[model samples]
Target: MFTSLYTASAGAIAQQQGLDVTANNAANVSTQGFRPDRASFSDLVHTGVRAGEDAPKTGSGEKLAGTETLYVPAGGLRQTGRKLDYALTDGRQFFAVRTADGIRYTRSGSFAASAATNGRFYLTDAQGGLVLDRQGRTIEVTDEHPARAPGAFTFRNLDGLRKTGDNYFAPTALSGAAATAPDAGLRQGYLEDSGVDLADVMADLIQQERAFQLNTRMVQMSDEVAQTVDNLR
Candidate 1:
């Protein structure tokens, strides 16, 4: 009976974690370049003496395993007529505007040149910071002439891109060095679409909900059984 209780408790904990992950994914469904997280579970250790078992001892209960971030790419390109809108064709990520916090990275290419505050055209992200060029230098557009357009941008290894939230990415040591110059041609009027699959997320949400409910019931049932066993004594 006690083992059953432990098992149910583990189930409840795991289910709760799953619910949280699902909720976050649902909330970010519309977010560009958002990657959904998934929950992982493991069985609990058992404390019992085994009879003639050469292997490790026996265990019967489940455990709430730690969750891992799912980095599966999502969303596609959404063509926007804006000149600065860019999307990576091969999982390359663009550097976000620099902030006091640190340089961040993101796959989101929805960029716009904001008005100059001090004789400088500030290229910023949604949060407004100086965007970085291939030289790891903040791109400052001062020329008012549209003819002097920044042509292309490129990265060394896009797979090492790290998510900094709000559709932002940052380069890691694993990301390798930035390219000497912008090699990838800039597509002036294109925006990256979010890769999230709404149908898949909805299905996962439903599955999580049902699993949580079932786990709750199991815990309750285990409690009742434990109480009944104690009452007989």
Candidate 2:
């Protein structure tokens, strides 16, 4: 009975996390270059002691393992007709930008022009992070249009990249290093829209709500059963 309560509680917590992730994805459905997130779950540890042949498998409960972002290259290009707008053909690739913390990576090509000390205009993200080039230096452009724009980098392993919020990502220990894909570069005058779909996010929200209710029911049922046993005793 106690095990059942624990299982229900764990499941409830996991469902709550799922709801949070779904809500966030829905909120960013229209955000440029926003990636959708999902909550991942796993069954709790199962214990078994061999009695005669095989012991019955008993599990503690379910748990929220982690959350993952779907970085699929699916969003279509949006023609903003602005010179600062940029987009990448590959979703795995990201433009490098310099933030107060350090250099960060982003997929949102919605850039703004910032005047540098020398009077030359430099590219920056909407939030003012300086855009970077292949050499990891701020990209400077004085001409109306350049033959080649700043290079977007591709990661060896995207799993190791950590989201820093504000549509930026930082490399972690798991990601070996950030490098540029020779073939991938920013497409001028275009921005990539957020890949999240409203329909999908809404469906996921309903599923999570039902799961949460189921878990609550389990907890209630287990408590009632325990109360009955005490009365009989």
The predictions' CA RMSDs to the true structure, in order, are 3.9, 2.2
Q: What is the lDDT of residue 118 in candidate 1?
A: 75
Candidate 2: clashing residue pairs, number: 0
Per-residue alpha-carbon lDDT of candidate 1 for residues 1-233, written as tens digits (9 for 90 to 100): 67666766777777777778778788887776565666766777765555555646655655557554444453566777766666654344344457656866665666667776576665667778666665556555544222233323335655565656776656678766555345463445666566557787788778877877787787789888878978999
Off by over 4 Å in 1: 46-50, 54-74, 142-163, 170-182
The number of the candidate with the highest lDDT is 2
Q: What TM-score number comes out for model 2?
A: 0.90
Cα lDDT tens digits, model 2, 170-196, are 998888688877654467889899989
Candidate 1: worst-modelled 10 consecutive residues by lDDT: 144-153
Model 2: residues >4 Å from true position, as ranges?
141-148, 183-185, 231-233
- Lowest lDDT sum, 10 consecutive residues, model 2, at 141-150
